[model samples]
Target: MNDPDGGTAAMALGAAESGALDRDAADPGHRDRFLIPPARGGRYSDSAYLAGNSLGLQPVATRNRLLEDLGEWARLGVEGHHDALRPWLPYHALLTEPAARLVGALPRETVVMNSLTVNLHLLMVSFYRPRGTRTRILIEDTAFPSDSYAVRSQAVFHGLDPDSTVLRARSADEVRDVLAARGENIALVLLGGVNYLTGELLDISAITAAGHAAGAVVGWDLAHAAGNVPLRLHDWEVDFAAWCSYKYLNAGPGAVAGAFVHERHLGGAGPPRLEGWWSTEEQTRFEMAPVSRPPASADAWQVSNPPILAMSPVLTSLRLFDDIGMDVLRARGMRLSGYLYELLEGIGADVLTPADPPRRGSQVSIRVGTGAAALCSRLSGEFGVVADAREPDVLRMAPTALYSTHHDCWRAAAALAALLPEVS
Candidate 1:
């Protein structure tokens, strides 16, 4: 059958395995830079890894750079702080510019430090100030567990009821409605840039503007958004944002995360921040004075010395993104994810992610009734299609642009068809 573009239906729809292979040949991504895992239970040699959203595949350069950092530690011991190749004292500095480029922020507005939740808490120390009747926090209904816990704890720390202080909205429209109605009561608006489970990409600029109009400080959990989508945190006028490195950033597990504080909130007599040795100005940090002299940058938000070892992988990953660029990656991601969504729909699977390319990222989740865990295990162990399961009945597959290919998406769809014959 012929398609509207005058190509065969299979070629146009990307339905056949050969069609996927053809697409890969025509539009090969940066797959060579990553190490693909070997298949455990399929005819193919490599596993069609679709779980970059959970934990990204290791970059080829990660090991050598990591070993080099370790070598510096062994060679210089205590002296490595100032004398090492990258210099442990300023190691985190190497990551700042590249990370800033990745998330579209100024160098002074971005800092790589601590875990995601830790950064959120530190930023909250300066941003989540609850006073009088304007003490509520607004968040999405499907906020990640860590975010839910962190916000609840913050409310508790402020001597307020968690249940009463936290308001959950079901969608972006609801968020707008809540802001319009109870805007005065909300002190902060914290939402995910991309919903983890549904892969929905919210309008950061619009939301931030709305929150500001309502007299609320806006922050974003970019754990799934940072590397997956293009961001302009500074241009968006975002008050603050935080993201982990292990997911779309492709750093190692529990790697050092990053935070962004808009330039408007930096330095001066702005909101008070929790301070430490690192928070003090670099020139006077060694003076050991009683009063801290924080810098006029996002570095003021840091509370402890950065772990050099953890920062190594993050540096490598950020450099990779810097070289390739997020704009290039985001475009490829939309094409790949759109193809996978179409294939899944052709097989009669129920997708949870938005159909429109602009509303979602690389992830495509599906409702598989009960046994979602069992289905995911079968996909990995039986078909070598690595996907992740979320709780009762959601299975997620991400066609990561850096390493994933159309052939990998084809394998996943074919596997689902074989396993779920009833649906097919």
Candidate 2:
């Protein structure tokens, strides 16, 4: 095996694992099931599965955990809320210790709660305070659309003009320029830890430093980056950050989201934010009090009782991370993603992800010229590659660490090289 095929064995193993999971997923009689949807014409088993940046594979443990939840409900009746087999009263707590370690946060500063947009809005309410002239937000031009929408809505919520209030970085240098010139007016800087489209890993520590220098708060949307890279939210001195666990975290679709509010802000009687009964003092949660007094940490940001079922998948996925460890996962992600990058480059593909692994994560965004989207379509529809396409061009492939093996990279690159001319 050469540059184009060196990773074959690894990828084949990954494909085989996917096939076994698919077989079990599709068969109702199998122990536990999930439907990953076959490649376009069933040409591949699970479509190369390189789009973990969009959604990771369902961990085998997820189905079992779900079954256990059902079993708990059956066995505990109404007591499941406080005295179930797994003890729902403190169920969310189980994830805190490991989840904190995964993203490099103190247990007190992290909490698994509402969806991404919802958490963003909540954190903003508490952390996005602006007075006099400091009231703008710095975000990336290439950020995902959902994020842009939420940021704009938040600006409106604060009676600010989206056009002037939303500061964007067209390039890394531009981010610095904005920080130098108008950072004083910026109350907060929100960025994706890794650009979802280009897969460029932003330097959060440096960015946080710049924001602080500008006297602006810094936060991040880690949807595509959290599990793909190592983070030190507390050490970075970040004001806050939020992420969805479904993508790189492999918690399955619509899994409960997590947020981190650095300990600097937690010890008080909660930062100022929206009111939810669940965030109220636990001792008086059911006292039927009319007022809401939020908890003293990130948990205080909650606005509702968490959807236990939505969060259950995370427990399953988190256990796997606890078993494998983030340092190990991140180390492998860099190596395998770099291998994919090398394989793509050997075929003369344009690399959209930053060449610096320090500035890249698990995904590689590559350009197959004008037909990259078509190439990506074919990878799924014809060649069984699960790569996704962004607008204009750029096929985004994320080789997840937990389930993805080295060989999948080779198979995907080979599939692309084989299909380019046809797409052209």
Candidate 3:
């Protein structure tokens, strides 16, 4: 059998596996720090996990750190608020600095709070102001379903029909064009830093500047970008942003998410925000007055008390990112994903992600036409390659820098070749 690159398939595969092993030896990622799952079908003992973009593997330190917080609760009962090891009263404050460092924001501009979509809605309350002519929200055509739902609901909340209030652009060029031609009619521009299905990394700084030039508020949903790529939300002057901690941040499922509001909009005559008990200044929070005096910091966005238990994992993960840094992780991600892309091309797989390194994150998506779900099942059961499927046609595999290896990419590519022998 011959590969699409005009080589004997068996010989080419042997050399590819050898090359992958050598690369792994030269560049061993932080795989030892994570818990790689046991294989379900292949000869190898451990599964080659390529699904980190969906859910990251657990860090070895997560269990111990989480248990410590649990132990404090067990020991202190109601007094845990002030008496626990890490006091629950100001527990969320522990995450602020590291979370700020992760997204390149000042401590006052960042807050680790509510779930991703929930935080989006909260931020929109302050950022999305629909004036007389500027009444539509601009989003990507491939925006995540949750973001689509949130923005549409925001339109309805303002007594506007969603169909006319939400505008979907297919690319960054289209976004810029929309801002130029219909800037006065667009109230907000909300887009993903790294698109979920296609793995396209948008130019955050340029797009933000364009939106500002057009007099529209610009924001981002960094669910796939926060930890996968380096970001400078403050420097870019992004009006607002939100990200989940579960994916490349490795903070576990439904972990506490982070939000950022640029310094220009901090306080003193900024747009109005929905307020609650926690929204008030901590110094006077216990005064329990009828009116709330919100602080100037992003903490003013908080509407409820921090969930100590749920926040523990986020703290642990953010500290890891702070220590290793996104620059190092991003460089390693490019190397690994570039190798995977080469292998996929050799097998004649139809890749959906951009080939340019700067235009993408760690995720590599391919067009599987149909039966993507079943193909993913076969990859896992027959070869122990753990990749994910996006409904009918898209298959996404991420070679996360923190744990994935070149050999994992080789496993995924080889498995696909065996399953799809006629691809060439």
Candidate 4:
């Protein structure tokens, strides 16, 4: 079978016993750079950690990286801005090149900035302009709640009714149809690059073209898409995008996030946005002039000086991405998740995520009958598996390419099979 990222699959692991797992282990070399907790036996081993969709495991390099930054801060004090290792003045640039590689954007179009929601609001301030009759906003009905809230609040800020002005589409085809009919009235089209609940990967390039054809600006909330899959944000001609670093990027919890604005939007005629001293030219930033002269890059979206300590872990994780590259990781994710899907199919549970290889990421969200959350609890406590439960019935399990193995997928599937009679 062809891999979703445009390569032929070398081999796909259909079951845990398949030697494909052994082959993948040597090539990508899993479970070494990461530090997974030992299962109760006092020996280090990978537990069934299937929750990268919610929070990723820590990279071992993060500790030394943080200590280095702290030591520099203690040694140099105020002088660290220019004198210490990784000079504080230009620290954010350290993450820019690797991050650009991960998202398929040029360095000039991307910036490591505030958290995901903050960047979303900041981008909307510049792009969500509702003039005269084009005052509506479009989002997926299954979008993460924070995205929906931000779009609704933007509509309200523009004096439009949240109920009527914020429209919801159920699928990609629906987006194209609506844009043909009502897109002339749309101020913005913002949707999740991957659905958080169902693990659906949307057709971003197609949607962006449709939105532009109808004269509406398009943006993507890529919190679930950024590092899980390969993205061509610039080649897709995306107007703007924002994503968090805590999930597949494997930065620490609530780590700093990132934003991207096309080169076309960074020029003098670009849309107006809220600015800070950091958005100005570095040579002139300390001048403290009253007027704003924002640079012609995505860095102009920065609202304040970055919190350096919070950004340290991002460097540690992004460096690993630079080493392994997105192509290998995405291919491994397909095999790992495909193994889990085969196991789950034999167990008779309803899998909500798309079965098509190209239409989904590494996650497999299962729909249990009655006690889904409690089943997840049992899977964690008794079976030593860690998967997340979303509300009533969905259990999201992600077999991350960085740390998880085919054995972990088998263990999780066996645990679910054992608990199914009680859950059903």
lDDT of each: 0.92, 0.79, 0.92, 0.86
- In the range 1-424, model 4's lDDT, one tens digit per residue, is 1112111111122244455357455645457899885553212254678998889989999999999999999999999999879888889999899989999999989999899999999999999999998989999988899999999998888888999999999988898889999988988999999899999899999999999999999999998898899999999999999999999999989999999999889878799899887888777888899887787889889878888898899999999999988999999898888878877775666898999978999899988877778888888777778899987888999989898887788677767766665656
List pairs with backbone clashes in candidate 3. none
Which ten contiguous residues of candidate 1 have the minimum total lDDT?
Answer: 1-10
Error of 4 at 237 (Å): 0.4
Per-residue accuracy of model 1 over 308-332 as CA lDDT, tens digit each: 9999999999999989999999999
Could you tell me which residue pairs clash in candidate 2?
A: 10-407, 11-407, 11-408
Model 1 residue 285 CA deviation in Å: 0.8
- Candidate 4 has its poorest 10 consecutive residues by lDDT at 1-10
After superposing candidate 2 on the true structure, give the runs of residues whose Cα lies further than 4 Å from its correct spot. 1-46, 371-373, 422-424
Assess candidate 1 and give its TM-score to the true structure. Answer: 0.96
Report clash pairs, candidate 1.
none
lDDT of 3 at 310: 90
Whichever of 2 and 4 has more TM-score, that candidate is 4
lDDT of 2: 0.79
Q: What is the TM-score of each candidate against the true structure?
A: 0.96, 0.89, 0.97, 0.93
- Candidate 1 displacement at residue 114 in angstroms: 0.4
